[model samples]
Structures are given as C-alpha cells and as structure tokens.
Target: MRKIASAFLALLLATLLGTAANPNPGYARVISAGHVEGVLPDGSAYVMDVPTNWNGTVLLYSHGYVPDGASNPARNAPSEAVRTALLDAGYAQIGSAYPETGWVVEGAMPAQLGTLNEFQARFGVARRTIAWGTSMGGMITTGFAERHGRFFDGTIAMCGLEQGSVANWNNALDTLFAIRTLLAPGSTAPLVRLPDQATAIASAAELTAALDVAQTSPQGRARIALAAALRNTPAWTNPAQPEPDANDHDTAQRNQFGALRQFLQTGLTWRQEAEAHASGNMSWNTGVDYARMLANSAIRKQVEAHYRQSGLSLRDDLAALAAAPRITADPAAVAYMIRNISFTGGLTTPMMSIHTTGDPQVPVQTEQAYAEAVTDAGRSRLLRQAYVHRAGHCTFTAGEMLAAVRTLEHRISTGQWPDTGPLTLNRLAEEWDPAATHDYVTYSPGPYPRPFHLHR
Candidate 1:
C-alpha cells in the first residue's frame, strides 16, 4: 500500500509541474509568432501570440512614444508575468512597433488595423478585441476607440495624455515659460526650436544650469513652486522612494522641483518635435489669466506655502506672469493638431482608464478632463477611470494591471461596472498576485486646467 501511494504522489507532482511548464491542453499555447511588415514606409513590425485553446478574446497593445532618435521596435508587454498569465488564460496578444515613433498616431492607427487584418488572415478573426496602451500609446488607444469603436469591445488607456498633444504640450509650455519668465528673466532662451539640434541641446544645458542655481535660493524655490502649480505638477515624482507624508511641505517642494528639473532637460527637444509635427508652433498661452489659473490650481495651498516660506509676494509673481509676453499658436498648426490628435469622449464601447496620482509626465488631472468630456457627451455610463497612489508614469504592477483587466472584463461581460474603489482594487490586486507591490490609493482627481476644448 505504501509503494502504491508513493507512486501516485509522484505522478500527481509530475502532472502539476507539467501543466506549469507547458500550458494545459485546453489553455494558452503560442499558435504563431513572427514579424510581419506594416504598411508604413519604415514598415510596422508585429508579434502575435495566441493560445491553442483560444478564448475568443484578443488584446491589441499600443506602446508609448519612442523619441525621434530612439530605436523603433520597442517590443513591449504589460508585464512579462502578466503576459504569460494572459496567454495561459487564452488571451491572444498583438503589438506593433510602429515604423517611426515621435507622435505618429496617424500612421499608427492604420498600422494597427493592418496588423489585425494580418492576424485574421494567418490565424482566424477574433470574436472579441480589446485595445490597450500606455503613455502616448494610451492616447493612440483612445483615438482608436473613438474612430474605430465598432472594431473593439473594450479599451484600456494607462497614464495616457487623452487631452491631445496640443493641450499637453501647451500645458508643459506654460510651466517652462513661467519658470523662464520668473527665475531666469534675463536669459533669452528659446522655448521653441532654434536653428539646429546643437542649438536646442545648448539651450537645454543653459536652462538646466539656471534651474540648478535657482534650486539653492528660497525666492527661486518659491517661483518654481508657482510654475509647478500652474501646470498641476505633482508633489511626488519618485516611485522607488517612500511617498512624503501629506504634511511634509519641504519634501513636497523637493518633489515638485525635481519634476521641474526633468522637464527642463527635455523641454527643448519636445518643442522641436512639436514644431516639426505642427509645421510651426501649435502651443499658445496668449489670453491665459495667471491669477485665475493659480486660483484654479489643485496645489494652490502648496504654492501659497512656498511663497510664504520665501517671504515673497505672490501678487508680484502673478503680475509678472500676466505682464510677460505670451506665446501664440499658428492657426494652420492648431488646425493640424485638432484633426490629427484629439478625443471627443464619444466612446461607443466600454472603456477603462488608469492613472497614477503622482505621475509627473502625465498628470492625474487628465482623468478628470476625460471624465468631464465623457459626461458631457452622455457617455459616462460606458466609461470608468481608476487611480493608483504611485508616483511615476506607467508604474503599475502586473497585479494592478491584471485587476484592471478583470474589472473591465467584468463590465464587458455583465454590462455592470464592478466596485473599483481603492480598497476593492487593492483587494483584487492582492488576490491576483500577492507578491506584487500594489499601490492603490483613494484619490480624487482634480480638473485639468487646460484640455482640447476646440472640438467641443
């Protein structure tokens, strides 16, 4: 009897490990995977992984922007572990490393469709498809849902700049413009593109030096805080470090300044690219009311605190901003942006968006802006937005990602939104992957001061 029991136990262990090593017969298995040329000039390349058991569902992934000179193929997955889990669960995954990457959504949308067509030709048509993306990719995903909503059953946009690149770039311009006008008034640094890359790089270096010097003074710190407030820059920037206590004013300022410093390093390059895309300047701040903007800022109290700490007059700073020469967008360029990139919140399918509360690159306020737009369009019922307490762009864990997917799936399958409160999300995340660093927090997003309003 003992010998028979030992043999049975050994057989059971082998069966479990075998299933773990290879997907079960009725589960995920890579049906086909290889690069297929896209329609764009540079030719989009894609990888499609599907399971043999094949749940009828498919996920089309869109990756974030690859800077002008960066490598084109950014082969990405939500998370490696999540990718494997998804595949094992019979979810087919497809992603295309777009031909050329700096804000190329016009070409990306078509490339994605072409890849889908390819998938259908090689494998079979997916009964259900969901679109998902991160950062600029999120913007692309939102655009896809808006334009091609019928093609997808659901969508997930993560830390996306759904307000359109125009509003996004303009908001960043407002912050840097304020910093330059307030802190380095004498420096004639160019905010838009200069004659060449060398000039742009040099300007970036000079701005960095100015910011370094300014960081040492209370008056400079006060001005930096005001600029950060104007742009709604978060008071937290690092995800690896412990989040500052709500009352820690000094740490808050440090975080804000760190974001400002990061923007300074990339501002020139961003402007140069924006110029190329719009055919000229597309960001404008000309009739903006500085005092009103400050009043509306989510971090007004922080600005006030920093001003008080610096013994500086807030009124003077506001006046300086109001009196400073404001930048204006070229009409043609503005029109280009309007048509090429923007979301009307006309969601025809269920959509879920997740954002980090302290993402310096893409502020949480974007969630509010999108929600407002969706509500205005009377499509709020089809949309849900969730927040994470983390302090970095696209910093969600595999567990968080999985929980969000499950939530969206529940909505799609049942036509009823699941409980997505912080506690609920945290619980789901822990249940999905207990070892993951789940950073769910109860966060009420503030209104985005500037959004693409021309469309509405």
Candidate 2:
C-alpha cells in the first residue's frame, strides 16, 4: 500500500498517539498479527485481521442470514478454518455483522461497504481486494460486485441465493402454499399474513404434525413430493445416508419429508420476520397455474412417480390447487421486497461461485438462474460456477472454498480463467489441505422453478 500523505498523517497524529478516550485510534501499519475490532459508523460491529507477512490483498467477507433470535455483533468469518487458512496464506480479512438479521440484504450491502471504508482509513488500501459471501451474503456480494466492481478485484459466493430476495420469498410461498392446501386442508397454516411470530410457529408445528401423519400413507407422500418439487428441494437431507439414486422415488419422498419437517417451520418463521420488515404480505399466487408450474418444475418426474406409486391421480391434486383461494400481495409490500435487492447481471468484477449439489435451503439451481441473468446482462464471461458433491447447504470444507479462491486469484493475477474442470479443482483443493476431503464435481443444475427477476 502507498504511504498516507504526510500532511494527513500529521493532522491525525494526536489520534494516532492515542488519547485516553481513544486508545485504539487509526492510521498505523498492522505489521504484526493483530486484530482491530470496533463498530462502524453505521453501528455495525466489524473485525479486521492482518498478518505479519502481508500479501497486499484483502478479503472482505459477508456472512449469511442470521435469524433475529440468533443475531449478534461477534466479529468473525463464516468458518474458523477458512479464516485461519486465509491468514496463513497472508491475506488480510475483514467483515462486519449487519445491524439487523434475517433477510437484511438492504442493510447488509451498506454494512459491508462501511466495513471496507473503515479498513481503508485504518490501514492503507491493499493492492487487491476480494469480496466473498455465503447464502444471503452471496446475494449481497452479487449486488456489491455490480455496483462497486472497482473496489474489488473479484467476488466469490458459496451456496448463495443469487436469485435475490423477491424470488426467494415467492418460491417459498409455492412450497408452503402446496403444503397448506394439500396436507392441512381442514387446518389453519396461513402461508402469508402471519399475525405474529407465535402464529407462524404454531402454524409450522401444526403443518409438521400433519406432515408426520402424512408420511405414513402413500397418498400423503405424493403431495409432499409436489411441494418439494415446487421449491426445487433436493432429496439428500440425511447426512448419514448415502446419496440416493436419482430415480429412487421412495427414497426421494422420504428425504423430502425429512427436510420439510424442519423447513416448513423455517419458512413460516422467516416469512413472518420478512413480512414484518415489509409491513405486509409479500407473497402471492393469484394468477399462477399450478398445473403449468408442476409441468415446468425440474423435479416433475419425482412428483409424478410418487403420485403413481400412491395410485393417486396427480391431476386431482393439481385441480385442488387450482380451486384453492389465491393470495395477493400488497403493492407496497411487493415494492419493499423488490428493493430488498435484485440483480442486473451487470457484473464488472470476476465472480466465482461454488455450491453443494444437494443444498436444500438454497438449491443449486440458483446458480443456473444467476448465470442466465449475468448472460443477459452481457457479463457471462466474468462468472464461473463450480459444485461440490456434498449434500447440504454451505457444507464445503475450507479446502474446497480456498480452491475456488485460488482459482479466482489466478484469474486476477493472469487476467484469464484457469481450467476449472472438476478434476482440476479437486486437485487444487486437495493440495490446499490434504486432510479435508474435497468433492468437486461436474454437474449442471436446471432452471429455478419459480424465477422472479428485477425488471431493471
């Protein structure tokens, strides 16, 4: 980093000398392994670490969604191992905890930038800066890259919901809607307009009880399959069990049930919080054609086979869904969600993303959807996506993530992408840490079942 102007240094000498009120004042070379922890101007707590052997590069990490109950100001990275590896590799790291949690993309985006500004003011600008995030952080990363590409040399997103906030809730509504209409027809499990957190919790528990009973009968299993398909949920919920065969409908239904047992409640609670943020319901199904949606779903085969196995007519379920009363979104609430964040694809920085092939929370198909958006924005060449053979959300080892980071760094250093085939990536990961098993694989995910994109 270039030296700060002498005049500017003199002006802040008193602060640097350390006043009684400000012991850890700014503008010093962080030569030794030291941590600078403080809250940003926006009240977001931030943490920064610089190694003795600085590599002239900084990694800006944006963490994933934390529910309100779990929100904290702890300054940390997504993973301890990854943070350690980055420091060991001589990369400075910085991140901030957003002021609010649970789908705070609007808040998170600025919080990250604020953290970066703090980093620049304390220490000089690094030669290179890389922005990376996971889950909702990934969404923030995508938007940040587009809006502030000059600030970063590259961007990396892992298991991210690149489809943005509006699409996320809309797709979730499809799954919850099907579950309510088909599984708990006589019961109350409002998919939207949740009165409060308690109501959402009760509804989720009620739906879960109905789900447990439905698992006993083939008829119920078939409907579960439909709901899962609508959300593009994978069939690999059990970490202990080996991955089921793609054509195995029985195992698929079982896995879907296992995931939804928790996901149903998760969706309800998250929607409740998100609705509270928007100040009204944001999901709707007024004009959606269930038959057409099921027909277009990537997991349609599983839904069809499960229905056939139960000796139930898939048409009947579709008809029932068609006849069910539809929900409409409040115009103001819809606007709030759209402004929460959306993508233009207008990617200026090189972006690398990795995902577990079977992530149930943020499905691999989101990668595909985001790729198309970038392609439409004429920025396809700036993006590269890879998948791990794991079976859960953000289940990547530190090695897997660094392998991707090295690949992007290579592109940054050489101005061209390296061979990112699964074989090549797996090799890179193994070299990073021979102890951690890497499962990079060549897989193509299908389109997201219910896509919602920004018109702009």
Candidate 3:
C-alpha cells in the first residue's frame, strides 16, 4: 500500500508540472515587463518596455512627439490605458521611445523592429505582429506601412498626421500661417485675445511660472485659478474650428482664447529635468531655434510666397507676422520622416483611421490626403475611415472606441476586413434642427462653394 501511494504522489507531481509549463491553451501566460534596448542600423540605442504574454500576436507601439522631452512611453497615461486594453485582449505589447522622438522615423523603425526581434527571442514565439499609435505614433506607423507594408499584419492609427511630401508640407505651412494671422494681437479678426499683448505674453509666462509653483505646491489654488482663467478665453475652443473671418472672428476668438487658457492651466508639465528625461535631449534650444527661425527674413519670403500660392494674403494681417515661411525641407528631418513612412508601407495592412472633422493640431485634411493616396494607389480595399463631427483633437466617444477595437479584432482573428459604407458625421443637433450645413471651408469635404477651390 505504501509503494502504491508513493507512485500516485509522483504521478500527480508530474501532472502539476506539465500543467504549469503549458498553462492556457489559447493564450500565453503573463511573462514579465522590462526594458529592452534596441539598436538601429545607424547605431543609435532606443529604450522600450515589453509586456510579455503568449497570445501569438506581438504589437509594436510607437510614441508621439515629445516636444517637452518626456521619453518614457509607459509613463504616459493614455499610452498606459491603451497598453492595458491591448494586453487584456491577449497581445504582447512592445512600447518603444523610437530614435529621439521629434518626428524622426528613420532611426525609429529599425529600433522598433529590433525590439520586436528581441521580444520574439526572449519569448520564443513566432507570433503575428501589429503596429499601433496615436498622433505622431500614428504618423510613424503610416510611414512604416507605406514603405514596409509586408512587415505588419495590420495597423491601428489614432489621430495621425499623414501629410508629408512637398505638396502636403506646403499645405501644412499654409495652415500654420493662417493660424498665426488669425491669432496675432491687434488683428481685428483675431482668433483669440488676452485683453492686451502684455496679457498674451503674460499667459505664456504664467504657464511657466505655474509649472514652477506646482512643483512645490502641487494643489495650489493659484494654479487652479490660472487654469480656470485660461479655459474662459476664446482661443481655447477647438483648434480645428473654421478659420476666423471679419464676420465670425469675434466669436471664434473668444472661444479659442478660453480654450488656450484652459489647456495651459490643466495640462501636464515636465520641469527641466523631467523634460530632459523624456526628450533625451537636455536643451530647450530646438524649440528656441524654431521660434527664432520663424522670425528670420529669408524664411518669411518663402512663407509669403507659399501663402500667396495658397490664395491667402499676408498684407494688412497682423497675424501674418506669426507665419514661419522658412520652414523648408530639412534633409535630415525629411529623411527622418521618410524613414518612419517607409517602415510601415501604406494600404497593405488592415487599417482603420479615425479623425475628428475639426482636429486643430492635426488638420482633418491630413487624414483625407492619406485616404486619397491609398485610393489613388488602388489600395482603398485595405483602409476604412470614421470621421467625428466635433471640434476637438482626436476626441472619440466610448462607443466609437469600442467599435474600432471590435473592427480591428475581427479583422485580426477572422481575416475579414470591415466595410467602409457606414461613414457619417458622428454628432447631431436637436431633432428639430435643420440638416447640417455643407460649407466650402478649409478641410471641409465636398465640392467647392463656387468655381474655385477654397485653398488651405
């Protein structure tokens, strides 16, 4: 009896060990999360976070621009939220701070893929790979899809800026000029006002001061007041609002001023060290240089010419002075942007792009240009679009988010691409309200209001 009992115990132990080794039949066990260093072909080191799971799908995530230098992708609240959501869905998440953030895609792609290779080696699983991102990440992913379409099974880009190339770049510069002209002080059709020029300058100064004060007093009322004050201004409204004109400038300006104020007050701030940590570059000199260059004469001539060609006049517009005309092609910068673009080839992967119709930071037309390009290239079958009818930056409702996730998962699991037939404006006014107006505004979709196109 004793011999028989010992044999039974040994068999049970072996069974338990086998179960531990194999765990879930359809999903890999949660392995670990750690930093992995990826080296680009150019020999630059990129640091990223890996959340291990064995679901047979590895996701490569690229982070957006870190203008203030914040580098840890894992630390961003939005990124953390998305990462958690994806991990819970049974994917191994690889988050990388790709090649010194500021829109440098050349070095970023290799570093991102290198990290993927490392994750694969560490886990020993030959899983399908997907690429995903928001804003700049979206841009980088699109760039990669355009060049390396075969690398990713699918891509999920949220509020990405897909406009590059000479034409798109020129359009972007024109929009910047318009914003400057509309927002500058002493302009009758100003997009926003701060009581006076001093106030405008003070608001920017106050933001820096509040950041300093908040470091010492995290919950200070002064910061709260500043935030509230900023929110009350007009410039803070949707950055994607229609351009200010003599007829609508007052209302738009008020809305924009309030919005800007609110953003500065409540937005996150990284002190000098924190910015340095995120950006990897310690100096704030790049931003300063960008600003100074905008003020230079040579650049102004290029900007003025571009504005004229776009059918916008610089004459008699105080806001025009804000235009940075000299923003020409920096070979290094363009090369970086191109690298990210080529890393993810376009229209080859199952992709769903959603953008707010009135996104200010990234113009809605940017997405349109991408979709048009895909269509023009005969790759429209692989892409679908959802447009939000709101005046916000990449803002989406919970329902929309869930819908997107479902569409993506369905494509990944069943190899069935979703249809693009249900495209419609996301918002509606009261039932009694008339049909939405279809004006010929910049970035508005439809035929021109008159014979000529409304150039941006």
Cα lDDT tens digits, model 2, 1-456, are 243345544533433233222234332333344688776444566789988887988988988888888956645467888889888888899998876677677667666766777778877889988889998888888887788787789999888988877778888888888888898896666778987989999989988998898899999999999998888888886556899898987887888888888798689998998898899998788888888878777789999988888999999999999998888998888888877776777898999999998888898889888888888888888999999988888989888998999999999999899999999998999888899889999899988876776644
Evaluate model 2: give its lDDT. Answer: 0.82
> Candidate 1 overall Cα lDDT vs. reference?
0.77
Which consecutive 10 residues in model 2 have the weakest lDDT in total?
Answer: 14-23
Compare candidates 1 and 3 on TM-score and give the better one.
1
- For model 1, residues 1-456, the per-residue Cα lDDT tens digits are 001134543553343334332222112223335323333223566667777777887788888877788886634366678778788888888877765657676667766655565566666767777889899889888887777777788889999987877788788788878888898887788886455567777777887787778889998888888988988888888998888887777788888888888887777776776677678877889888878888888889988988998999999999998999888788887777776677777888889999999898888898888888788788989898888988999999888887888898898889999998988888888887898778777778887878775438
* Order of quality (lDDT): 2, 1, 3
Better of 1 and 2 by TM-score: 2
RMSD to native, candidate 3: 15.4
**Can you give the TM-score per candidate against the true fold?**
0.89, 0.91, 0.54
Tell me the lDDT of model 3 at 456: 25
Worst 10 residues of 3 by lDDT: 446-455
Write the number of the candidate with greater TM-score, choosing between 2 and 3: 2
lDDT of each: 0.77, 0.82, 0.44
Candidate 3 regions with alpha-carbon error over 4 angstroms: 1-53, 71-78, 165-169, 176-250, 256-346, 389-391, 397-399, 413-415, 419-456
